[model samples]
Structures are given as structure tokens and as C-alpha cells.
Target: MNSTGVVLSAGDWRLVLDPHRGGMVRALTRRGQDILRPMPEGADAPFDSACFPLAPYANRIAGGRFTWEGQAHVLAPNAPGQKHPLHGTAWLGNWSVETGEADRATLLHHHAAGPDWNWAFTLRQHFRLTADGLEARLELTNTDDSAMPAGLGFHPWFTRRGVSAIAFTAKAVWLADAEMLPTVRATADTLGDWKQGAALERPDLVDHCYAGWTGQLRIERGDGDIVLEGEDTPYLHLYVPPGQDFFCAEPQSTMPDAVNREAPAPLLPGETRTVTMRIRSA
Candidate 1:
């Protein structure tokens, strides 16, 4: 259970996690082989990197700081030389184990510390392995007596080596400048014609987030295909690290500047926000 932190099983699938970086190594089900896995440390690896929470939200925030409700808040630098805090504070911290069954595990990460973000709150991440596929859910609550703006998303680096055809449909697009921050609104056309799905030939160089997904994503390879869908998570972040063999299909409720731009639903006093996603093998 604690040898290499790699959860493996021959019955259905395997689940791997690196306790140090809070990374998910592998999540496979009966029908599916593995949803997310750790690649050997080397060149041309699909996703040898770690997965973090994009949070407090995900993606990039210019200058690692943002203005909300006329108040300025600065987050610690998660991305160096970029001047922005990324993926929130949970992914880097060791999450407290709440419950771990044979096929499921629930982890809690409470940032009820000092007042930093618009609202101080407690968050919980639930990781589970089911008969269909692996699933993740994020739950957050506003500890403040008033409403606040908070975004949530997951940064899961999927194996892109064997993946050939990828396709999905989204309705909205956030225009950004050189810094990868949302600037204006446009049709999802600029993201390229992914309607018919494109080969994973050159995706690593891309570092952008997309919104208004139809809740279904299709990923096809030579041997297998996968379909991802869910109810709570409406937005998706498409991160392709240049030259790497993997790409990240992150799901979330808001974008980078959602807190400042008011993109998703608004939170009220004692409001709880939840985002969930499911992956079904095809």
C-alpha cells in the first residue's frame, strides 16, 4: 500500500499517486487500461510531470495577482518568470486522507488559513475508481459570511504517445494576450478545427484554456478510444507542453481571470461549489 505509492491491481485497473507532488500516476478501469499514468523520467515522455490543482483555480493569472471586489490579492509564484500563481495551493500541499476503500479514496485539503483569496474556505477532492473509469470531484465552500469569486479545475497530464486522433466541441473561447490571460471573446474557431479531431502530432507547444465544452471529449488511438463527460465541469483546459508526448484535458468551472471577469456562476453566502467529471472507455 505504501511501497512506491503506486496503486496497482490486476482485477480491474491501477491507481498511482506520488505523495510528494500530489500527482496521479495511473487510474485505469476494467474496460479502460489506464486513464492517467506516470511516464518514465526521460526525453520524449508523454507525461512524466505531476498534476496540480489549478485554483483557489487553474490556468494562469497575470502577475500572480488579481483585483476582485476592488481588493487586490497576490498569490505566491507557482510559475517562475511568468509573474502569476498557477493551479492554486492544494496540489503542492500534502492532502489529508479522509477515507480510502478498496476502489475509492477521498482526500481533503483545507486552506482555512489567513484571508488571501476573496473568501477563505475548505476544499475536498474525491478520487475514485469505478467499473466504468476513474472519476474526480472537487468541492469547495465559502467560509466567509458573504459571497466571493472562486474557480476550480484539474490539470491531468494524459498519455499522448499512442493517441492519434482527438476531437471535441466547445462553444465559447477566451481571447488572451501573450501572457495567456483572457482578453476578449470570440468563437471557438481560433482554437482550430478540432471538430473532426486532429492527430496528436504537434500539441505540446500549446498552452491555452478553453471554455463552453459540450461535455463530451473523444480521444482515439490505434488500440483504444475514450470518451470524457460530466455534469458539473463545463469548462476544459487544453495544455500541451511543447515536445512532450502527452496533453492535458483539464476540466473546470471557470477560466484564468474568472474571479475578476465573473465568468461562471456566482457564489452566495455559505454557498458550496462542486465540479465533477467521468471518463468512459470506448
Candidate 2:
């Protein structure tokens, strides 16, 4: 069997993963209908996949610069035409399959200390398909002898064609500047209530992080509703590009430039942190 390409299936749910291509979920379907945007066959870019894991950190780190333990560290932009290092190295690094079965698979990635991060770490991602939905778990462990700042998240691209409404509760939302960095935080009352729900159609491009998220989101589509639940994720980054066929409802542990914000939790040597997400259709 090709370890690079693995599929997990349970009941009507099927999930395809590419461990060599940033360990991304190439496709996710329920009864042959895509629950997430399906990547074309042979696609190697993680950005084009149905979902991907974010580890060591999530989102961007302003200008690829951060100071940890009084030492300045710099990271080169991993994505083309972008100034900041995006997501994390886990999505761009090769992952080795540690175990697999008919309905579940686990992949592992180890990072050595480099100029970009300046610390070593190990990341593990597990994908499992249940009768009604999918569950994903990510764990990050600091392997270096010193403490390191870390964050975890999952970026999932959902089909936006028939999405009618989105509902979630957040205390505040971060407004970004032209460079996509947080400029100001607006309260829900001022920004508008997503808790009661809001129309998916919006006039402006939506790419911002909602702080103090309730870790629950509902997407109402023409065929059915997709419910997302996260464990220990306090932030949600919503990316809805106008005139696009896909949108992302990312469950994140921190906002963009989290390292500059000093928001990520510090992991001591040999310490591990984990995050889990569940997606269900109704």
C-alpha cells in the first residue's frame, strides 16, 4: 500500500490524506458528496486540500520575527508572495505514518532546531472517521532543552456554494490592517451578533480572528448543516473570500502574530500540548 496516500472510511464518511503533501486531507466526503472542498487528484499543495493541521504555531507571525526567552528568532516566508511565515512547519513538512487501519490513521513529524524556529519539536496528527462525522487530534511536544512557545489548530476548507448561514458566539473580533495584522478588536455588539446567526453572504472580504470563541460553530447549507466543535480552542479564524467556492472556519489556539503577541503557551522540555476538533453533519 502507498503510505503517502491513505484513506479512512466509516459508514458513509470517507477521508483521504496525503502524508507527504503537508499531511493534508485531500478529500472528505459523505455518500460521495464532498463535505469539504476536494483537492484535485495529484495536487501537492496543502492550501488546495480539504483540511490541514497547524502546529508549533498557527496563523502568521508578523514579518516572520519573534523574540522567545529574550532571544530574537526569524523565519522565512514559507508561502510564496507572503511576508510572514504562515500556519506552521508541520503543514509543509513530511509526515511519517505510525499506524493505520480501516477507519483511522496517525502521522508523525519531527522538526530539528533550525534558524527559522530555533528549537526542536515533534508533532503528531491523528485522523479518525466515525459513523456520523470526522475527528482530528493534533499534539505538539517541545523536544529542545528549553521552553518554547507553541500553538495548535486545524484549517479546514468547506464548500461555500450552498452555505446560507453561519452561527457562532465570540466576545470580540480582531480587525486587520492592510497587511492582515490585527489592528483593533471590536466587540460582538458592535461587529454584529454571529451567535444568533448571520447571512453567509457578505459584501467585504472576511479574514479575521474571533477571540474568546465558544468553540462551537454551525454552517447551514442547502443540503444539511455542518457543526464544528473544538477542544480548548479559544480563537476562530474565518476566511471567506468573495466570489470563491470555498471558505475556512479555522479553530485556532491564538490569533495571527501570536508569537509577537506572546499569546501561545510555553511548553517546557518534553512537554506536550494537544488540540482536537470534531465535524458533524446533520
Candidate 3:
């Protein structure tokens, strides 16, 4: 392993993580078959990796604007061409390896109070490979003196080849505007019977947040089924671009633009919140 990379293996599964590259899982494979989309060699962008952690908050904040506790804050877009603050800062920040073994590894990243969000916190990501699958845990603690709005999640990109169906349960879904910001909330049933599973290929692009999620999802492929289960995550974001090589089934603690909505949970000083994603193949 390199200075910034860690590998974990158990049974026929293997996971590669790079602490220097947003602490992302660069590759996930079972018996030499890609589960999540593998990162290209030398790829440094967090979005290019198989999976990355979302901390403090998840998804976009409209025009990078929000108000909390009587104070207004504006976050600059981290991406070159985006107008909104996409994802969170932790994914692009360097993390230090806290522990590593053949089957598990832990990484820690600390974000000091700054103009970006004006909050201090510590985030921990743990990855473990089991006999059947991989388990990931994200824990965030408020290190500041005042309470702060926070959310946690994981964005995993699964290879789209031969992906025939998807299954999940949710009560409502958010319709996005041209800029991909939430515009309206609609009953998920209108999107079809996703609970039983739905065809993967759709004529239109899908980039919406499903509210009241059951914290469970399954992606059916030609070889096997990939199941994702989350704890303490009430929202799931589905990003399936037309003709894309990969799709994302993200499990988040809150909805997109949560800082502007009522979804973000407040974390008091010294308090910690955790969200876990378990991945298994059937």
C-alpha cells in the first residue's frame, strides 16, 4: 500500500481506499469483478471514485446560501464549474489513517471552524470487509461550542452494465428544477412501483431525493444483486443519468438542500451522530 492508500480483504472481496483522495474507496471488487465502479488510475477527483463520505451535510445548497441560529452563511462552490456548494468539504479534505488491518481500516478528518461553514468537527470513516460484503460507518462529532446543523451519508457509484432493476421503499420524492434543486415534493408511487423493483433504463434522467426512505435498496445485475442497508438514514438520492456508465444510490441522513430545509438535524457541542451503510451481494 502507498502512504495514502489502504487495502482490506476478506474472503473473495477487496476494497481500496485513498486517504489523500477524499478518503474514498477507489475500488470494490468481489472475485475480481467490479461491484462499485472502479476509479481510473491516478484519478484524484472525489467524484471519480467508487464511493466517498458526505459529512456536515449532503448534496447541494442553493447558491451556497443558508441561515442558522440567526446567522447567515455563504459557502463558495468547491468545484470549478458548479454554482452551488456540492456535497461537503470533508470529501475533498485529507484524512489520516487511524487504524488498518487486513480486513478493516479507519480514517479520521478534522474540520476547523472556518468561513466556509463556521463549524468545527471531527469525522471518522470506518470500512470493514466481511465474509459476504462490506460495512461502512461514518461518525461525526461537534467540536465547537455552539450547536450546528449537520448531516451524514455515503455516495456509492455502482457499475451500470447489465443492471436490470432497482428496488426500494419511500413515501415521497423531490422533483428537481433545471439546476437540480428541489422544486416540488410528490408521492413516490407516481414514479411507479419501486418497492417491487423497477426497470433501470428510463427515457428521462433521474436525479431526485426520496424522502421517508426505508433505509434499504437493491440493485439487480446480471451476475447478482447488490443490497444496501442503512441505519439512521431517512433519505435516499437516486442519480441515474441517461446513457451513463454508472448510477448512484446514496443513503443520506437528510434531503438535498437540507440546510435550507427542515431536514438537517442539529448537533450540540460534544454530541455525535453516526450513519452506517452495509453492502452485501446475493
Candidate 4:
């Protein structure tokens, strides 16, 4: 089956959804070229690429060499660092369309049982269009003969232009190594404070992950505000690239290096796991 893409437009906002590959919201824009950066003449265009995932996993995995169940599985690197296996293959793989109706669509994909997870899997992603905003849900189930470790999340690029203030609550903070991987943990106060619903205004460089989130965030622009409420996501990662057009506010389950740490409960065969998030114009 071909990759499925759907467009939802409201006034000046346009969201493009591709169901086949992790059901990613591949593009978001009004004029489309507003975020264009200078590219090499004849190079592939950025707009043509998928918008990427929004959670559980963002960015890349080094060399795809993580150990699970004492076994190593190689993953292909799809980003700048050749040393890392970027984003899960589901985002690039084909997804079957289960149902499509007005304002909503559902898509599904399956991965073979692996040695580490030991379970066959089926994942479903849902998209719903509404006058308030767009909502996307990702659900996964262990369909294998055994239980396995699983991680899930979102990776959306959000508009950060003229964002005067950002306010939120955080409880946990992770210390990262030079490679940008989580290495340590401490009380949020160690970094500053564990304040919730506090306002931060273009304060400084931030590419940090925070846990103990309430799943409620508000981004205040000069003229408008956007509210994002995450369901089943207790952790949040805020990525603000220097002088970049877009920033990412991701909600995720399972911390980085979960596979190595053998973190949390595994998805048992016949059991389902899900994460959902809602975005609305405020």
C-alpha cells in the first residue's frame, strides 16, 4: 500500500498527516516556505521529508547497538550522526489504513517478534481533526509469544517564533553525557527548582528533558496562545535550537537508555499500551 497523507486546514494553519510511517504529522505551516533555510543548490528539499515522531523516542540511537536480552540488534542510521540509529523504522515503514472517516482516520502496522522484546507487535496511530486543534493517538500491543521491552513517544517540531514566554511544571531532571545521552539524575532543584506552571522567557539554551510533568503546557505568543495536554505522558522534553525556526516540546514514556537499564514493566503478549495527546488553539 502507498503512504497515506491527509491535510487538515483551518484559516492560515495547515497540518499534513502521513499514516503509513508512524502516522507522523509530516508538515505544519501556513505559507509552507516560512521555515525554509538555505540549502545546497539541487539538494533535496526539507519540506519533502516527514515531520518525524513526537515522543517516547526522538532523535537517534547510537549505532543501533543497544543491548536487550543480552542480544544486540543493528539499526540503520537515518540522521546526521552515522554512529546512531535514528528514529524507529516504523516512521519510514508502510502502515495499513484501517478506517478513514470525516475528521478522523486510523492506521496500523506490525513488527515481527524480536529477541529482546520477544513479542510480535501491532501499533495503531489515530488522527482527528477538529475546530479547536488536531489530536493524535498512538497505541501498541504485544502480539508475540513472549513479553518484551517497549518505548513510545511523540516528536513534533513546534513554532517558536516570538514566543515571549513558556510556562510549565517539572519534577525530574536527567543529567546527560557529552554525547547528549542521559547519564545521571537529581532533584529538579539541583538545576534550579521543581516549580510547576512557572514562566520562562527565551531565557537560555535549553535541550533538556524533564519528568514529573502534569501533561499541561501553554505556549504564549505575542498574539496567540497554544495549549498542549499530553495523555499518559509523565515526561516532557523541551528542545530549543539556537536561532532555529522550530522547537520541539515532546511527551514521552520510558527514559533514554531504557533498554540498557531494563526499565519498568515489559509489554506482555496480549497486553496493549497506549499514549495520547491533544493540541488546541487557545
Per-residue lDDT tens digits of candidate 2, residues 1-282?
254379889998999888675878888887788889999877788888899998778888898988887988889999987888999888988888889999999998999998667789999898899988899999898999999999899999998867888899989999998878888889854555788888766778888899999999998977788899899899999898877888899998878898887467689999999999998886
> Candidate 1 regions off by >4 Å?
6-11, 19-34, 37-50, 115-118, 263-269
lDDT of each: 0.65, 0.87, 0.89, 0.61
lDDT of 1 at 68: 59
Listed per candidate, the RMSD to the true structure in angstroms reads 3.6, 1.5, 1.3, 4.6
lDDT of 3 at 113: 93
Candidate 1: lDDT over CA atoms?
0.65
- The residue-level lDDT of candidate 3 at 227 comes to 90
Steric clash pairs (candidate 2): none
Model 2 ranges with Cα > 4 A deviation = 1-4, 189-192
Ranking by lDDT: 3, 2, 1, 4
Total backbone clashes of candidate 2, pairs 3 or more residues apart or in separate chains: 0
The lowest-lDDT stretch of 10 consecutive residues in candidate 3 is 1-10
Q: Taking the tens digit of each residue's C-alpha lDDT, what string does model 3 give over 30-80?
A: 888898999998888998999999988899999988989888899999887
Q: Each candidate: how many clashes?
A: 13, 0, 0, 16
**After superposition on all CA atoms, how large is the RMSD of candidate 3?**
1.3
